[model samples]
Target: MRTLRMILLAGMAASALTAPSAGAAEVTALDLGAATAARLAMGHVRFANGHDYNATVGFGSGAFHRPGDPPGTLYAVTDRGPNIDCAEIGAVVGMSAEALCAGDTAAKVFPFPAFTPTIYTLSIGDAGVEIVDALPIKTRSGRPITGLPNPLTLTDTEGAFDADGRPLTPDASGLDVEAVARAADGSFWVAEEYGPSIVHIADDGRVLVRYVPQGLEKDLAAADYTVKGTLPAILAKRKLNRGIESLGLSADGRTLYAALQSPLVNPDTAAYKTSRAVRLLKIDAATGEALNEYVYPEDEAASFTADAKAGKVKQSDVKISELVVVGQDKLVVLERISKTTKFHLVELGAGASDLLGSPWDDPKTSPSLEATPDLAAKGVIPLSKTLMLTAEGGPFPEKIESIALLDESTLVVISDNDFAITGDQTKVVRIALDKPWN
Candidate 1:
């Protein structure tokens, strides 16, 4: 069985997504169990509800690398702590389903209610992955910010509960950070899902300014950090929990690229589930203004041959997970289903339509951009894409949310383990291309 598995991985590694392929790509797997074991040994995590999750680091939320960082050294961020929806609360916590989940708002159970999201500096080597340093995301007052959902007055809000089935209050400062990009000055820009917001943090981990969709400023007024409503108003219509999930920063740190995880519920939820149009934005890093917006069409569900043969799947299953900047106007977009992942090289200049102020961005437009059946028929041109890599089956783990390039010819991918909520372990895969990406 081991020999057969190795042969399968070798074959899969040789498959290149782009044209003019070289030879087989080198593949390596790094297990993060050592970091988890080390954390447990030091008692780094304390569960308030008495439920020991035996959790992993959950470092796959986002990844970043400064221009001059050493090879094999990258930074990763964690999402909201170990949590499960209401449906599994009964079995996982051995508690009544109605106690915390049956109220006016359904709440997710957080085993570590006070857990804060953190940034980890990782060293990837032949032996395994190592955690060299860690930084906690905090507020200006130096108070660590929890991962709980924010209490917003304008848009939708999700509630949360502690492990003991105790309802937890919504915090305006809470952030469900999904992606991070480091600035030249050593500060950080993070993409979040709760307010579906973008936040700028200082070098010491203090939030400098948070930019949300227009009209959300009033909602986050009480937040300790400065809040700005600079993003387009239409972005507020994004599907719940499906917000900005991918972010990339230019080497000069003057521009940023951000993408929504899935199509927005422009017309309604039905349109969102069936739509292929995903919004990607190019923003001015200094001003937080969206300079341009382009539509990124996701792949059809039937295209994933192996996954479709197993069972039924829908277009909604495909989502944008991460974005990596490779050139001045070029990026690598990571989109995936649960079992299959694809990396596409996308260029921002020319031949692509910028829909910044078009009707597609207007909230009052009927049959919204997401609902439009044919954008080409309306003279709209989405970004042109070239497939760079298609990874599935052996050596590729599910829920791969973060990706980075170690060199011109090497790619690094990380999978989110959900803090071992379902017995999943955080895994990292390193792929050395036969030829350089340039």
Candidate 2:
């Protein structure tokens, strides 16, 4: 595999990867390697915590699309820092939850409790990729926020330890920021996996407000920042680690669209795994209120990683990593299930039914949205989707987690490098769409 990686790198140096769009049209690509001083800083963190930095520079999880920026300039975000497998954890498996919080932490990953999610301003071109500037997300009081998980009382969570196997407590301000969008006022809206919440960050990175599910609004209100439970209450059923994963701002910047990573744990895990209907929430950014919800149905599997398709893995493999608003009411959604990543042009037509807090949410409904024999027959018109491109047979990165608009005619993509684990490298790919509006 290392040799293949070397050969791949050699080939990459000679030519960038290219893949076909629909029809005879092909989306040409320009690949840029990202190098930053941040890797050296993380190297120290790795040695101290026994957590190796997989990639050279690790800021490649979520993406923030900034329109009208200087050409070749784009923004991307990093999620909670590098994580390790359970077997890689440095502690005993069955330690008491209480004991896990009092002592020092020995967690193989997250040993540095102070690791913060970072936003990167990337300048990408044929020359290469470089960080123009970086911003560290912080709390309302101007304190840096960690990437650690929130406490279990508020939601499902995991305990933390240090490299030597000691206990650590949860931090309320911790955020696993996945999707980001820049607001007109220079502030930002970030979608977090923890609260499955939408957080407002001042231009300087202070958390201004957070909107989460209704039931937990009060639970997290007393934190050192503002918290509101304004998203649809049904969102409370969001599956673990599979909350809002992608965010986009409407052209006018008045509306925010958030895509759930996978099906919610509404009826049960079994139902969620096989369910195809994932939810997309349209929210009023100013009020932090859910204006409407649309469904993106995962079609019957015609293609999937053999393992995932063979029943060796859970059926909840399909996920939405990032979505961008291209046309007036049309969204360019990046959908993937394992090695196959496809871009779909979805339109939020006004004729579609609003599924927020609808009967489809009732656990008792015989035909769950996932099981609905025919959504259209029941007057439930899903957001119209048109195939744009598929990377199944293309030269694309493994985890293209974020996408942004470089201009009305171009799109840019970034992949989470997992710090380069398994030889995956962070790359910036410039895609000139066949149709900018598509």
Candidate 3:
């Protein structure tokens, strides 16, 4: 198979590779070329762990398309800023790990605490990818919002600190956005992991309405935008940092579907670590009301062919990163571990059990929905899933959090690169599938 590669070199020219046979698949990395508008200048930071932080704009957090946009145009959003755990900072700051973070192990230090989440318009072609425009997400007052963690009142929260080991106040408007979907009316819906919430933004990037789980409204009361407690309350059980990561919008933009990144802690953390039961929500786009919910059984680590080959044997490592709607009640879900990614076509219309108001939604249930191993034996039917593609090794990189259909037979994927904190460059890859998804 012919594989194309591109490295970001100043004034480097891009070349196309020969296409594979009709029945064979191909993967090619788009040459981002030189660092221009897409690159963020956060200066340099010497971490206590002997690692220097290199600033780069995280363009892969989420991606979407405007219905009437150019064929190769896509809009992408960035996540929060560069952050490291206190344990990582304690080592370099000459302080004990426990003492430096005020005994909160979940505490993190943001080197660039003011980095704002922004969206970019990209154009893809044979020459590579080009950044056409950018829009920084803003509040009602027109001020950009940071990516800092929110101080949740009803749900779990983490502490935020600065480079000097000083505590940083949490921002109610802070959002760790993971996915984006555009509506027919020009507004955008973004999935956030911090509130595990969904935010609606006007065409100009101004926050319109923010939706969160029940009882979590008070926490974001200080936010500049309107807040609604419209999601299921069980979502508060989402594992810290692993909330709603994937989102999909129906063709007509009347419905929205959100997928949890992992199983909920339901009863406790032990259940979350070993459970394969992830939740998917179908919401009313116009009202933010959760219409129904479905179980999305994430595969075990051993099932991911690439991870097995690499000997990474933890089922908890699997996560749903992105979703693409193909047809009515039909969508493609992106699941991945660090080194491997898989796409599965999921059907939610027939034969799937809706657990909306069932015992599974109740936190008091004895065997939390997540703790149940044999969901089928329990008469609980999950959404039907068929593996569409397995992307392993080469061309593909770690933390590929965004994907879009470039055409009926091809897909474009982007890696998060964690803002290049570890010296990894963000890569955009195009994959030609063996068969057309249409």
Q: lDDT of each structure?
A: 0.80, 0.70, 0.81
lDDT of 3 by residue, 1-438 (tens): 454443323333454333233222656678887754335556776645445656878789888765566778887888887877776655444455555477676788787888888888889776778988888889999999998989787888889876655788989999898988878787889999987899999989999999999889888999988989999999988998899989888888999989999999889999999999899999999999899899998988787766778775788899999998877878889999877787888888588999998999999988888988899988899988877766665666778899887666767899997777666777887776667764
* Consecutive 10-residue window with the lowest summed lDDT within model 1: 1-10
lDDT of 3: 0.81
Task: Rank all candidate structures by their lDDT, best first, as comma-separated numbers.
Answer: 3, 1, 2
In model 1, the number of clashes is 0
List model 1 lDDT by residue over 1-438, tens digit each.
Answer: 011122222223432222223322566776555554476231223334354556655889998877788887888999988888776765765555576465523568776778888888888777668888888899878999999888876777777877556788888888888998888788999999877888999989999999999999888887888999988888888877788999999989999899999999888889999999999999988988899999998989887666777799999988999999999879889989878888888899668899998999897888799989798998889898877677776677888999987777777889988887867877788877777655
Q: After superposition, how far is residue 428 of candidate 3 from its true place, in Å?
A: 0.3
Tens digits of lDDT, candidate 2, 126-214: 66577787889988888898888776454566666643345556777888889888877888888988788999898898899989988
Give each model a TM-score: 0.92, 0.85, 0.91
- By TM-score, how accurate is candidate 3? 0.91
Return the TM-score for candidate 2, rounded to 2 decimals: 0.85
Please list all clashing residue pairs in model 3, or write none if there are none.
48-92
Error of 1 at 385 (Å): 1.3
